[model samples]
Target: MADPVKHYQSEGHDALSAISQAQRIAFAPMLFQASWCLREIGVLAYLEDRGKEGATTAEIASHCAIGEYGAGVLLDMGLGGGLCHLVGDHYVLGKVGKYLQNDPMTRVNMDFTQHVCYQPLAHLLDAIRAGKPEGLQVFNPEWATIYPHLDALPEPARASWFAFDHFYSDWAFQQAQEHVLGYAPRTLYDVGGNTGKWALSCAARDPELEVTILDLPEQLALAQPRIEAAGMTARVTGHGVNMLDAEGPLPGEADIWWMSQFLDCFSHAQIVVILKRIRQHMKPGARVCILELFWDRQSFEAASFSLNATSLYFTAIANGNSRFYHSKEMYQCLREAGFHVEAEHEIPGPGHTLLVARPLPQPS
Candidate 1:
């Protein structure tokens, strides 16, 4: 079946539109910084507060306490970027400007770019050339991947990383709980369960349910106090191990394996290995639920843009070999792991798709 939502046209552009797009790409860095400063320094918010009548540059400068020269340049750049509108001497928030101030996704993306991906992205060319996560050198010289050092990342970077992760996955948790709990699975495995958000939620929701989170030791350490604080220490536990370590095996006690925003952290080959390992350990009748933002499955072009851009972040910082896989690629991995997708669901949020798979019955 063809995907009606997936369409990318390859067409020639006229001279003016071509040049306009080229200029947008060329000045994107400057515009991004300008937008960030405007948001951080209160220019965007001030204009938003001023409403449709907007505010003059003098008023903005006075309110923000920046010099008129500084305010004017940012505001002008905002106009060029369609982030603000200049009518007469007043500056009003454009559609883009409003979202910049009020959108949670925008805020998370900005902070993540600034604190986590910004410096690392400078080494993206090196990473691509070497086919490795060379950009992670920004954080630590010894670490081969970002997962192990997540807890140890510097203040704003660590905060920003979690914020970015949660911003995309958190909204889907409620729907996820409903979907999984409907099956009445007594035991759940939370793979790559950072900080135990899902574990904490599921355990609290079902008195009979127990959750085991499998992640690196550092991440488990961070989740420990939180689980204890939630008074779910008995029901929710952390298993400290690297899922990518082929020699190590997953616990087979889980009635359901839940991986949310997890599988994309590994390459296609690694995804197969991880899935195969899980299949080996899954209890009879157990199911694996995978939640991801598959680029080819996105409903909108903007969502696709975000996921595609995130694939680069994975290459440059998180790990060198993974990507935001297409849905077909994910399905292929499931089949290779000896599981068949029994159901597919669209989580009630942006860019999330869930695949529920069951193990292929063993031959007699």
Candidate 2:
């Protein structure tokens, strides 16, 4: 594999270019908001429909039901941000504008950032100083993290949060399911199984397979209805327990333990503690499968950039201590928890890495 560090090893831009980049960063929030408004207000879509012919500022404003001045200002920012281009007096949708208007990934990311992270990020420095998710006060001052309040989050916030959470993992689930089912495990434990989506999917694939969801009580409550709706209540069950609580009981008979994009929600020290707790209860010869998007293992620099930016969400909103991790840090945590990695598989599409591990042999 090519060294990921090569991307960041040198300053690639001259001073003039560097200053231009810095200025862009300074006004990035304004550009992002302008781009979002253009898409949401139908300006980009109207431009897209106009195609090569494009549309004049008055025509766009009339079609989108906004003032011509408002349209012109946003269009000017869009041009500067590379979201649109001006042809004489007309504006046409650029590649970036088209992406913002129609790309599923971009749409999901934009909404997630807007509804979930944007306002909370204002408290990022406070979160850093307090070593807690201080920004969570944007919703409720008493809540420690966003997980418990996920279902309670208002309309687009809840929708966007789940969409963002599931988008990357959902794409990789098919390949991951096939890989895990290869072991023919009768019982699979899905740690951090929010709403039991993975559990339902796996149960549907294998009739005899019994799946258990281990998560918070609230999440289990949400999953119960879905399990009954799927008519898999018999095959799928919930175990309400917080992984953060060391004293929480973990079932010992499962053939495989699955944690999908779960461990990264925890601090390194917390991860080791959680893993060590699971190590004590895992049955002999059982496998633990961890699926995560390690920033360093990404095939593209853009994927790395997205993952790194997401780390701030964890800090300011989700949980102050945890961030998307590197593969090496996870490996170290596994080893510290008395387990060893037996295999690593890179799930195609979403750039997720699955690490399969087993407990270290007991001393003779």
Candidate 3:
């Protein structure tokens, strides 16, 4: 195998560059909070509306209904952070600022961080030391995993969590549908199907297709209704079970077993268990499709960076044992679970990779 580092693009840095990078790292939290404040306080919105003409500090303060001093402080921070540009006495939204205001992905990510990650992230070191989700205490004290107690999360946080979860995967569904349909499967089992989005999509694609969702009870409550709302209740059904339970029974004979952005929520050992369970239940020649964002397989440095950063979130809150897997790690898990990669498909947009694996024949 070629050196994985060969693909990494490096910016040749001088002493000044190193100093600049160090300063950015040291002040990142402050910059992030300031930018969030700028967006929440209406500074970015007002500037975005103004366009090239921009808005004066006093005008922004009056429009946003805040004191001019506070407004000025945030505006200065925005200017420093490159979120906005200062032209004479007026401020205009920068490229980054416009994204913060208009991008759906940005909105969801920011809200998710604010609601689900921020407080818990503070305890990340503790979580790492304990090898458990120490930060999950912020949401539910009894549950170790976030999925089990998702419904109990405080109002907007719950809303933000689902929105964040769906927004990332929904875009990839259109691409995934084509891959799954190519095999002409009559029955599709959606493991970890949170809100039945994929099931609804499949129902529309093939009316006669039987779609079953396997997830926790709390998740099914949200999914069953959406399936009905999509008028897919006849074709789509929910089966409540914990995928993480090693000894749990799994329904068999599905032609296609699909897991979208789901396996990354587990450790390597757990992934093997889940895959082995699926293999045991699946019919002969059945295919298991795994859709995930593998850090090493990403086309860009930023995508890999974002994924690596998210792995910390898993350590601190999600499961405390899972991470964004490298493609090699996933392959090893598949091999250990008595499966071989039949095909690998790289999906467009946001660096998602799909692995289609087939179960090895069991000995007589």
Best by lDDT: 2
lDDT of 1 by residue, 155-178 (tens): 899999999998889989998788
> Candidate 2, TM-score vs. the true structure?
0.98
Task: Report model 1's TM-score to 2 decimal places.
Answer: 0.96
Q: Residue 43 error for model 3, in Å? A: 1.2
Model 2 clash pairs are none
Measured over all alpha carbons after superposition, the RMSD of each candidate to the real structure, in angstroms, is 1.7, 0.9, 2.1
Question: Can you give the lDDT of residue 286 in candidate 3?
Answer: 87
Q: Residue 324 error for model 1, in Å?
A: 1.1
Better of 2 and 3 by lDDT: 2
Candidate 3: 10-residue stretch with minimal lDDT: 1-10
Which residues of candidate 3, in runs, are more than 4 Å off?
A: 1-12
For candidate 3, lDDT tens digit of each residue in 30-141?
A: 8888889989988888888888999998999999999999888888888878999878998889999998888887888888888888899999999999989999988877
lDDT of every model, 2 decimals: 0.89, 0.92, 0.88
Which parts of model 1 are misplaced by more than 4 Å? 1-5
